[model samples]
Target: MHILVTNDDGPPSNQSSPYVHSFVRSLQAAGHTVSVVLPHIQRSWIGKAHIIGKTLIPSYFRPGTLHKDDGVASHHPFEDGKEEWVLIDGTPASCVQIGLWHLFQDRGPVDVVVSGPNYGRNTTALFSLSSGTIGGALEAAVCGKKAIALSYAFESREHDPEIIAAASQVSQKLIEKLTQDWPEDVHLYSINVPLRNNVAEAKILYTNVLQNRWTTGSSFEEAEVEEEVDPAEQEKEIREGERNGTNGADESSVARRKQKRFKWAPKFTDVHESVRAAGPGNDGWAVKEGIVSVTPLKANFCHVPNIKGEIKLSSKTSISGDQILASSSMPKLYAIIDYPDPYVQPLILSAIRSELKDLDVELISSVQQLPSPASPLLQYRDYESVDFEHALDQPRSSLLCAYVVRKALIRKHYLSNTISTWLVKHPQSPLKTHFKAAVNFELDYAEFLDEALVDAWDLNDSMTRNEARGNDNGNKEWWILKPGMGDGGNGIRLFSSMEQLQSIFEEWERDEENSGGEQEEEKEEKEKVHSPSSGNKVPTSASYGGTMTSQLRHFIAQPYIDPPLLLPSRENRKFHVRVYCLAVGALKVYVYKEMLALFAAKAYQLPSHLEVDLSCHLTNTCLQDGPSREGSVARYWDLEDTAHGPDWKEKVFEQICEATAAVFEAAAREQMVHFQTLPNAFEVFGIDFLVDSFLRAWLLEINAYPDFKQTGQQLQDPLIGGLFRQVMKVAVRPFFDKEAEDNDSQGSSEMRLVRDIDMGRR
Candidate 1:
C-alpha cells in the first residue's frame, strides 16, 4: 500500500530529527511503498498555519553525504524512482499538503498519514493548539484520511540520542500494528512515549489532555539608579531625521546620531502563581508519573444543542404489564451441550445466564434427550435437533457446534447465511480468492497451508522474523531460544550445546514415565511431579525437559530480545498493545473496548542464557520473573503511577483507535479482501501486538473473543455503559421481536379454542 510519511522533525539532513529516517525505513520493511516529505528547516510549534498566496517549491538539501573513515560511501541519493530526500521550504503542515495534493495524486489517494516523534508531550489544551506535531495530523484528518502524531517526552535532553533511537524502534512497531488492525472510525491519534532507558518497562497510559499552564518567573529585579534624560525624546529625534530623509548635519541629526546607552536592569519578581491544576486525570499527570500517554482527540468539538420537541412515543411500544407477562412466559433458553471442555462451557453458561435471566436453562447431552428438560415455556424435538446426531459424529465436536449454531441462527433469521453463500460464489470479493479464503475462519490450517505457501513465495522473507533476537548483557553470540506457542516463556531453555538438549529430553522422558497412569490419576501424578516445592526437585537445567519440553510442540527458536536500559530516576517500565478489531462487514457491533496496560520493574529481570536464560522482551505479565509479578496485571488506567500523576486511560484509547484505523486502512490496501469486509458485517476483534525497542509494532495474535471483563470494569462509566447498551439493543431486538410475534400467534389460537369450548358447553 502507498503511504505518505511526514513529520515535524523535518528531513534526515537535520541532525535534530533523526527518527524520520528510521520511520520511513520501517514502513518500507512492512511492505508499504513510502514517500517522505518534510521541511527544510526546523519549524517547531508551527501548529496548523498554512502558507497563503505563496507556491510551495521542492528543493534538495545536501547535509553532506555520510561516509566511513575509509572513504567508503555510507549513503547515496536516489536518482529516479526514489529520492533520498525532498525538502520543502514551508511549515510541516505545508509539507503534508504538498504530498497529498501533488506527490500522491498520480498514485491514487494515500491510505494513511503518520506524523512525528515530536520532542515533547502534546497533551491537554496544548493538543488542539500543538502546531508542530499535531498540525500535520490535523491536516490529514481534515482531508478525511486517518493520521497519527507520535512524540517522546524525556526528563532531560542529555539522553536524547538513546531516546530517539528507542523512539524509532517503538514507532515502527506502532505503525505496523496501526496500519494492519485499527478500525475505520478513528480519524487521528496523538502518541507520546516517555523517554527512559527501560522502554520495555514503560507503562502505556491512555489519557486525557491536561489543561495546566506552565508558570513563568518574573524577570524584574529591585534597583536604585539616578534618573536619566527621557529616552523617548531621543527616539523621537532619530525618527524625525529618518522621516525628513536627511543625513543633515543639523542639530536634530546630530542629536539623533549621538550614541546613547543606558543600564537595562530589571528587578526579579517572584514566579507567577503555579497553574498546575488543569483537571483531574489528565495527560500531564501520566507524563509526570513516567508513563507513555496515548490520547485520541476528535477533530470536531462542537456541542450541538438538543432542540426540545413533543415526545412522540413509538406505536410499537408495548404496555409494561403486558410486556412483563409476555417476557415471563417466554421459552427458557437451554445451553447446548456441545463441547466437553469444562473451561469454555462455564463461560458460555455465564453469558447466557446474564442475558437470559428468569428463563429456564438446562444442560442436555444429545438431541434425543433435548426434550427431557421439562419446562412449560420451551420444547424441542425437531428434525434440525436430530441433525445434531450426525453433526456430533464428526472428528471435532467444536466445529460441529459452530456449524449447528450457524444453521440455527440462519433458520431463525438471526443471521444472514446469504453473505456466506455470496462469499462462496464470488470467492474474490476484495482480495484474490486464495487470500480471501485464507482469512475466512472456517478454512483451517490445512486448507490455508497452500495459500500460505503462495503468500510466503510472493512476500519472500518479509513474512519471516525480521531480525534474530538480541541477547542481554550485550553478548551477541550466545542466545536463549523461545517456542512460539509457549506462554510465559514456559518452554524456553538455553541451548549452548547439543548435550543440554539431549539431557533435557531424557529428563522429560523420566518424568513422563514416573507420572504415567489412568487419565485422572496421571493428571494428579503429573501435577505433583511438577509442583514447585516437590522434594528432591530437579535443577533449572534438569527440569527443562519435563513439562517444558512437551510444551515445545509448536515453537520457534529465537535469540532472546534484550531488556530495556534502566535509568535510576524513572519508574520501572513495560509496554504491550491490546488491539481491538471487528469483522469488516459483520453486524451486531462487537466493540472490544478497554485494555490492560501492563508494566514491570527494571529490577524485575528475566533470566538470560548465562544466568538462567529469562532476559527477553516478552512483556507478558505472566512471563515476568519477580516477587511483585502479580501486580503487573493491571487495567490500562490503573497502570499509572498515581504518585507521579497522569491519568492516561482516555488518551490511550484515542491512540488505540487512531492507530487501529491507520492499520485497518493499510491492511485494506495491502490485504484488500479483509478490508472490504470491515466496518460492515463484523463487530470487533482484539489484536495483541508488541512494540519492540525500535517502535516497530509486531503482531502477536488475533483474538476472536478478546476478554472484555477487564475492559467492562475499567470503563464502568455511563458513556461506556450507554455504548454497550446501544449495541446490545441493536443486536437482540430482532430476536425479541420474533419472540413477541410467536407469543401473539399462540395467544390468539388459545382464545379461539376457549370460545369454541364455551359454545359447546352452552
Candidate 2:
C-alpha cells in the first residue's frame, strides 16, 4: 500500500518532533511505500486551520545531510532532487492538502494518509478539539482518502526509543487492519498509543472521546515580566541556544518571543487530575490505563436528527451519527424493576431519562443476569442483597471503578437494634431523645426471646414494674412486635401483656405448620397423580420460599407511642412521615425534603381490646386496600396548613435531619460489619418517623428500596420523581460524567446533606 505521512510535529529533532522518523522507518520496513510531508515547525493545537491568503512555499529534506544548525532547515531553500520528505511553510492541514494534490502526484495516488505518532496524547475533548494532528487526518479524509491520526501518550517528558519503536509496530498493525476493512461512514480515526514498555502487547480498544471541560482556573495566565532583568543574561541565553546548534527559529522560539508575551504553559496538573477522576471506557481512560484507543469520527460536524416533525425517506432507515456515538459512548444502566412498588419502576426510568439524559439502559430481571463487565449503574430490586449479600461480599474491581451498585448496607434492623444499642452506649447522644427503646431477639431462640420479654417489661431494671402496671390498662406500656427483616406491615402484631406477646408467637408457629402441611400435601398429590400418568417418579425439590414469619428468625419489639400527632383536618387520622434519605459511596447521607405523610385508613384511637384493628394504628399505605390507599397519602409540607405554628413543620424537619445524621453515624461507627459502606454502591431508604402530640419526632423502622406507590399519584412526580433525580445527581452522575459539572457537592437544592463520612476519595 502506498502511504502519505504528515504530522503536526515537524521533521525529527532531539526535542519536540521525535517519533515521526522512527514511525516512518517502521512502515518502510513493513514493505509499504511511504511519502512524508509535514509543517516546517510544530503546529499543534491548530485545528484544521488553513492560511487563507498566503502561498504555501515548499522545501525538501534529505535523510542524512541535515546541517548541525538546521533545526528548521526546511524553512529555507533546499534542492528538491533526491529528497524524500517535503515540508511546507503552513499548517498541518495545509501540509495534507499540498502533499495530496500538489507534491505526491508522482508517487502514484496515495492510498492512505497517516498523521502523527504525535509527541503527546490527544484523547479527551479538551485536547482532541484543538489537535492539529487530528486536523491533518480530517483534511485527508475530506480530500477522499483513508486517514488515521496517531498519538503517543507519555507519562513524563522523557521519551524511550524502544517503547517508541514498539508503539510504531502496534500502530502499523492497527492501521493495516483498519484500512483493509474501513467502514464507509467513518471518515477518519483518532488512535492513541501509550508510550510504555508493554505497548507491543497492549490491547487495542475502540473508544469514544471523553467530553470534558477545563474548570481549573484558566489555561493561560497573565505573563509576568521582571522589571530589573539583566540584558546580558538574556544575551547569554541566546548565545547558549546558538552554541547548541539552534538558529533560534525552532519550536522553542515560543520562549524567545518579545516582552509582555503570554507563554503556552497550560496547567497540566489540573488535566492530570481530571484524567485520574475520569470514568472508565473512554479514550482518555483507556490511554491512562495503558491500552490503545481507536476513535472513529466524521470529518464534518455531526448532523442532528429531526426530533420535531415529519420523517424523511432515504435508501433505508439509518441511525444518526450522534445516536451512534451516544449508543457507544454513554454508560450502560442494568436496571431491575421487580420490586412490588408499581410507581417506583417508572419513576426510576423517568429520572434516568431526565437527569442522566443519555444512557444504554437494559432492563434486566435477576441478579444472576447481570451482564459481563457489569453496567455502571446496577439498579437491583432485591432487598436481601442490599442488606447482607453485597455488603458482606465485595464486588470485583472491574465493577468498582466509579460504579454505583443499586444496594446500600443500611437495613431495617440497623435502625431498630443497631441504633438502639448505639444510643444506649453513648448516653450523651442527642439521638437518645428521638429514638425509641427496643429489644431485639431471635424468635426461634427461647432464652433470647425470654430475655427480650423481660427487657420489654423492664423486669431486669425493675421487677415490680409489671405489678405496678395494671392488666390491659391504658396506663400500661403497649409493645409493637415486628420481624427484623419484614416490610409492608408483614409479621407485625400489637400486644400489651406477656401472654398476648407469647400467643402472637404461638399463632405464627401454628400458621407456619399449616403452611408446611399444605405444601407437603400438594407435593404428594402431584407425585401420586404423575406416578400413573408418566410411570416415572416425580422430583421433589426442597422448598425455600416460605412466609416471612417462618423465614426470618430475628424480631424486634418497641414500645408503641400513643397520642400520635393527629391532624384535625381528616377527622384526626393518625399518620407518619416517610422521609427519603440517600446514602452514597462510603458514605454521604442526604435527606429529601419533599417527604410523604402516610395516613392510616382509619381514625387514631388507643387499643381497648387485645384484638386491635391495625388500620387505626399502622400508617403504611400497603396495609390499606384499594381506593383507601390512594387517599392515605399527602405531601408532608402540605400539613403546614393545619400545623399549630408556621415554623412547626420546619422544626420537625430539622429534628428529623438531626436524628437521621445520628442514626447513620452510629451505624457507620458501631455496625460496620452489617453496614459495609462500599464506594461503588448507594441506596435510598424510606425512614419512618412518628410525631407525638407535643411535636417531638420519634424514629421508626428504616426500609430499603422504599415503596414509591405509597407516595400516591398526586405526590409521585414531586416526591418520588424528585427524590430519584436528586439521587442520580448526588450518587450516580459524578462517577461517570464531568465532575466539575455533574458533581453536586451540595446534592440538590432540596436534598440536604445531613451526614458525610469523609473517607477521602479512593
Candidate 3:
C-alpha cells in the first residue's frame, strides 16, 4: 500500500522525539511504500491554519540542517536510502494537503494517510481539535481518504527509547487493520496510546472525546530571589560587556527585577472522572489509565426529526467547523436530488450549468439512492457542525447536499402565524395589522372556544332559545375544523352544528391511538363527508400530501374568512390569492412578484344545516380543480378570466404583495432563529392569502414545501425556471468561497429571479 506518513514534530533529525522516524521505518519493514512530508519546523498546536494570502512551495529541504541548534549532525540521520523528505513552511495541515495533491500527484492516489506520533497526547474535545497532529489526518479524511491521528501519551515530556519502541509497535498493528478493514461508519480515527515500557499487557479502549469549554488562565509574575554568581569573574564579565555596550542580559538592577515572567499558559482540561461519568467512554481517561483510546467520527450534524423510522445519532461528538476547515484544501460541491419531481429536474440541470458543474447531481429515487438513507426534511439546526470548507468532501453514506428537500410540516403554519401575531403584539416591531392575518395565539391542539373565531352554536337557535329560557351565555362553542398540517384542502370541514364537530373530534381520537400519541375515549365516528365525486356516490375520503392519521395531533383553527370578494363570472364564488415566498436562508426571505388565483367550485354561502359539505368552501386546487359542472375545470385565473378586470387585479395585488412581505419579515424573526445553521437548508414557501371585501389580504397559512407543478390551467411561468439558476449562484457556491460569509445581510438580487424584500434586519 502507498502510505503517506507525516507529523507536526518536523522530522526525526530535527525533533528530539524518535516516534516519527521509528514509525516510518516500521511501516517500510511491513512491506509498504512509505512517503514522508512534514512542516519545515515544529508546528505543535498550530491547529488547521493555512497561508491565506501566499501560495505554499513544498520545497525539499535537508531536515536537521534547517535547525542546526537542535544538535543533530546530519539531515538523513535515520535514512536507510528508502525514504524521501519533503517540507512546506506551514502548518501540519498544509503538509498533508500538498503531499497528497502535489508531491505524490503522479504516484496515483494515496492508499492511506497516517499523521502524528505527536510528541504529546491529544485527548479531550478541545485539545483533539486544536492539535495540528490530528489536523493533518483530518485533512486526509476530508480528501476522501481513510486516516488515523496517532498520539503518544507519556508521564513526562520526554520520549525515551523504551517508550518509542512500544508506541511504534502498537501504532503499526492498528495501521494494518485500518488498511485491511476500517470501521464502516467512520472515515477518520483519532487513536491515542499510552507510551510506557513493556511491563504488561495494555488493552485498547473505545472512547468518546470528553466535552468541556476551557477558559485559558494567564498572568505574569516576578522572581523574588537574588542571583548568585562568581564575584570576581562576574565583575570582569560585566566590565567587558559595559565596554562593548551589550548589557541587555544584566538582571541585578531594580528595573530588571521588575521584568515580567510568565506564570501560567493556556491549556485544556483532561478527561477526568467527572467527564467519564457523562459518556459511554472518555478518551483522556483511557490514556490516563494506560489504555489505547479509539474514537469514531462521522460527517452528519443536523437533527433528523421527521425521519421515516428511528432517529439515529451519527457520532458521539460532532466534528466542529474549525476541525473541518483546518484540513483539506480541495473545494467541491454536490447536490442530492432526493426527488424526481419535474420541477426538481430543472434545478439539477441548472446546478450542473453553474459553478457546481464539476459535481454530478446524485439522483435519489429510493432509500438506496444514496450510500445511506437521507431524511430531506431534517432541520438544519446543527449548522455549526457543517464544515463549509470540507462541504464538498463526500461523506461515505450520510450527506446534506447543496439544495435541501423538505416536506410541508405543521410547525410551518404555527411559525408563520405566530410570528405575525408576535410582531403585531410588540410595540417596538413597527409592523402593523398587515402581519395580523394568521392564527392569533400559540398553537397547542388548536382547541375550540379558546380564542375561537365563529362558534358552531350559531348553527342552532341555541342563543335565542337560551335567552327565551332565561339562561345566560356561558357555554364553549365549536369552530371551523381544519387539520393541523394540510395541503390541497384534503381534510377540511365547515361544521354548522356542534354534533358534526363532535364526530370529527372522535375520529381524531382514533388517529392519535394509531400514532401512539395520548389517546382519548374510544368513540367510533364515521369519516367526514367531502366533495362530490364524478359519480356523486359516496363522498371521497382520500388524504392528499399527508395521511389523515398524521394530521390529528397537530392542527390550527382561525375565524373562517367568510363573505370574500367573488369572481363575478361564477357569482358569489369565493377565491383566495396564492403567492410564493422563497427563503434561501434564515433572515433571507423573498416574495415572488406573481401569484395564482384559485376559486372554490360552488357558490359561497353560510351552511345553515348540520350536514357538512366541502364543495361550497375551502378553495384548494386538489379539491376544486377536478371535473367541473359544465365540462370545464375552474382554477388559477389571470386578469382576463375575472369580471373585475385588470384594475381590480392591480388593486388587490398591492395588498397581497404587502401582506406577504410582512409575513416574510415576521416569520424570519420568529422562526429562522431556531435554524441557526444556514448552509444545510434553503426553502421556498407556498404562502396563501385571502382578499377580504375591504381589499385587505388576510394571511392564511404557509406551506413549507411548495408544490411547483401546475395544478390546473394556471400555466406555470418560465420565470420560475430562473429561480433554480439563481440558487446555485446565490446560495450553494457562497459556502465554498474561502472569504468570510455575510449571507444574512441580504445582498443585491437580480430582479428577474428575486426581488429585494429586506425589511431592515434589527
Candidate 4:
C-alpha cells in the first residue's frame, strides 16, 4: 500500500520528537512505500485549522543528524540518511493538504495518510478536542482519503529506543489490518500504543474517546516574566536587523525585560481523576491497562439524544457531508421498498433512482443487507421503526404516519367529524363554507334508535325536521354509512330510511357466521346487485362485512348530496375529486395541484330508497369490478378545461386548498396527541371532496397512505412519480447534500404551501 506520513511533532530528534522516523522505516520494512511531510516545529494542541494567509516554504531534513546549540545548525542536526523528508512552515493539517495534492505526483496517488505516532497520548475528548495529530488525520478524511492518527503513550518524559521500536512495529501491523478491512461509515481512526518493552505483544482493543471535560480550574497561570513580547514588534525588529547584517537576538532581549507574562500551566488533576473513574471500554482506560486503543470516528460532531438506543455511541455509523461530496465512488444509500402495490412500487423506485441520478448515489434495495444507519428513503406501507427514523422522516417508509393523518382521518369517524365540527364553529373557518354535515356513532348503538328518534336527533346544524326531510323538490334525505377505521370501500352502505340502515348491520352478522366458501358466493351475489338492470335487490354488504369484526364497531353517517355535479363530457357520471396534500415538520401543510377525478362505474341518479346500487353512488375505482371502466380516472386539469366557465375549476380548487388547510389545522389544534406534528416526520394524504351543481366544493373525508395505484397507469407518471420526486427533493436530499439547504425548489411547483406553524420555540 502507498502511504503518506505526517505529524504534529515535526521531524524526529533525540528529544522533543522521536519515533516518527522509526515508524516510517517499520512501514517500509513491511513492504509499503511511504512518503513523509511534517511541520518544521512542534504544533501540538492546535485543532484542525489552516493558517489562512501564510507563505509556506518547504525545507529538507536529513535523518540521524546530531543536534547542536543555536537552535540546531541551519543545515540541521538530525539523522544522517539518504532519504529526505519534506518539512512545511505551517500547521500539521496544512501539511496533509499540501502533501496529498501537490507533492508525490511522480510516486502516483497516496492511498492512505497516516498522522502522528504523536509524542503524547491523545485518549479522551479533553485531549482529542485540541490535538493537531488527530487534526491532520481529520483533514485527510475530509479530503476523501483513508486516515489513521497514531499516538504513543509514555509512562514518563524520557527516551527509550527499545520501547519505541516495539511500539512502531505494533502500529505498522494495526495500520495494515485497518487498511485492508476498514469498517463501513467510519471516517478515521485514532490509535494509541503504550510505550513498553512488550508493547508488540499487548492486546489491541476497539474503544471510544472518553467524554471528559476540564472541571478543576483554568489551564493558564500568571508567570513573573522580565517583559512582554509582541509578535508584530519582534517581526519588525528582525527585518531591520537583517538589513543591517546583524541578528535581532540582543535587541529582542532588551525589549523583553519590561513586563510580566502568563504561561500555560494546566491543572491535570481532574483529568487524571476522570481517567481513573472511566469504564474499561474507554480509550484512556485501555491505555492505562497497557493495551492499544483504536477509536473509530466520523468527521461530524457527536449528537446526543435525551434517550439512547441499544447500540453504543461508538458502534453507530456516520458519514460527514464533506466526505459525501469529495468521494470519487458513488455513495451507497439503502432504501427499503416494501410496499406490495404493483402500480406504486415500481414507479416510486424509478422516481427515486431518477431524482438522485446526478449525485452518483447507489440505491440498495435489499433490506436484509443494509448497512447501519441507512438512508431515509423507505417507501413501505404502515411500516415504522426507530432504526430508520431521522431528524426528518422522508421517502415515506419509517414515517410516523398515524400521528397527523391516519388517526384523524380513518381510525374513528366520530373523532374526524367532531374535529370538522370544531373547525366550522370558529367564525373565520373556511370549513364553515366547504365542510359537509356528518355524525358518528357505534353501529350497535345506531341499531337501537327508532325512525322517529332518528329524525328528532340534531343531524344538520339544528335544521328543522321538515327542512332536514328534503330539498325543494321534496326528496327524502339519503345517508351514506362508513365503517370506522375501514378503507377501500369496505362495509359502506347508502340508505334513505332507518329500516334500511338497521338491516345493513344485520346482514353483516349473518355474513360473518357463514363459511368461507359461502361468504365468497354471498360476495358475488352482492356484486351482481350493483347493476341497475338487476332489479331492486340491495347490494348493501361488501366482502369486508364478513371480516370486519374488529373495525365494525364505530361508523360515520353523512347526509348524501342529492344532485352531485355531473359533467356532460363525462357521460353524466358521479365523481369525487381526489387531492393529495403533504404535512411536514410540526405543521406545514401543502396541497399537490395535480389532482385526480375518480368516476363511479355507472351514470348518476338521485337515490330515494334502500334499493340504491353503490355503482351509481360510490366513485372509488376499486369497487368497479371490470377493466371496462378505463376512463374512471382523469386529470382534474382536463376537467377544468371542459367546465362551462374557464375559472370554475380554479375557483373550486381554491376552496379545496382552503378547506384542506382548515381540516389539518383543526386536527393538530384539537387532537394534538393523536395528530402530533413531529419535526422529523411527514405524510401524504388523499382528501376526497364533493362538488355541488353550484360548483361549490365540500370537504368529504381524508385518507392516509392513500392508494396511489388508483391513479392508474395513464396518470401515474405525472401524478405519483412527480409527487415522489418532489418529496425526495424537499425532504430527503437535505440530510446528505448541503446544496439542498440553499435551494429547496419550494417543494417543486405542484405543491402549494397553505399553512405553516413553527415549532422551533419548543
- TM-score leader: 4
All candidates: TM-score: 0.32, 0.49, 0.40, 0.51
TM-score leaderboard ranking: 4, 2, 3, 1
Per-residue error for 310 in candidate 1, Å, reads 42
In the range 287-334, model 1's lDDT, one tens digit per residue, is: 656666666665652111231122121122111111112244655333
Measured by lDDT, the strongest candidate is 4
The stretch of ten residues in a row with the least summed lDDT in candidate 3 is 316-325
Which is the better candidate, 2 or 4, if ranked by lDDT? Answer: 4
Which runs of model 3 end up more than 4 angstroms from their true locations? 1-332, 347-413, 427-479, 496-499, 507-551, 570-572, 610-612, 624-626, 629-637, 641-645, 671-680, 712-719, 733-762
Worst 10 residues of 4 by lDDT: 312-321
Clashes of each: 73, 0, 2, 9
The reply for model 1, stretches above 4 Å from the true place, is: 13-15, 61-83, 106-108, 159-162, 179-185, 214-280, 301-762
Ranking by lDDT: 4, 2, 3, 1
The candidate with the higher TM-score, 1 or 2, is: 2
In candidate 2, which residue ranges exceed 4 Å CA deviation?
Answer: 1-342, 358-414, 445-472, 512-550, 640-643, 741-743
* lDDT by residue for model 2 (420-497), tens: 678678877768889777666666633245665554544233324543675546676677777777667655667766
lDDT of each prediction vs. the true structure? 0.43, 0.66, 0.51, 0.67
Q: Per-residue alpha-carbon lDDT of model 4 for 1-762, expressed as tens digits?
A: 568999998887645567688898676544345788899987877879899889998887756632311122234423322256789999999999999998766555787899998887888887788889999999999999999999998765456777887788778767766776676677888889998767867878788878888786555544447456664454344333322323334422222344656544444555567788877787888888888888888876242222211111111111111112223565445454445454555445445555655444333344445444334344334445323334233433243333433476546484556566576567678877786556766545334545324543655333344345654324566677777766666567886655566677666666666737865766644543343223322375433344444345677777777688898788888889999988866767888989999998888877644356677777877666554365788998898444547888888899998888877877777666567677556677888998888888977778877888777644656678778666666655543455774565355568787887765522
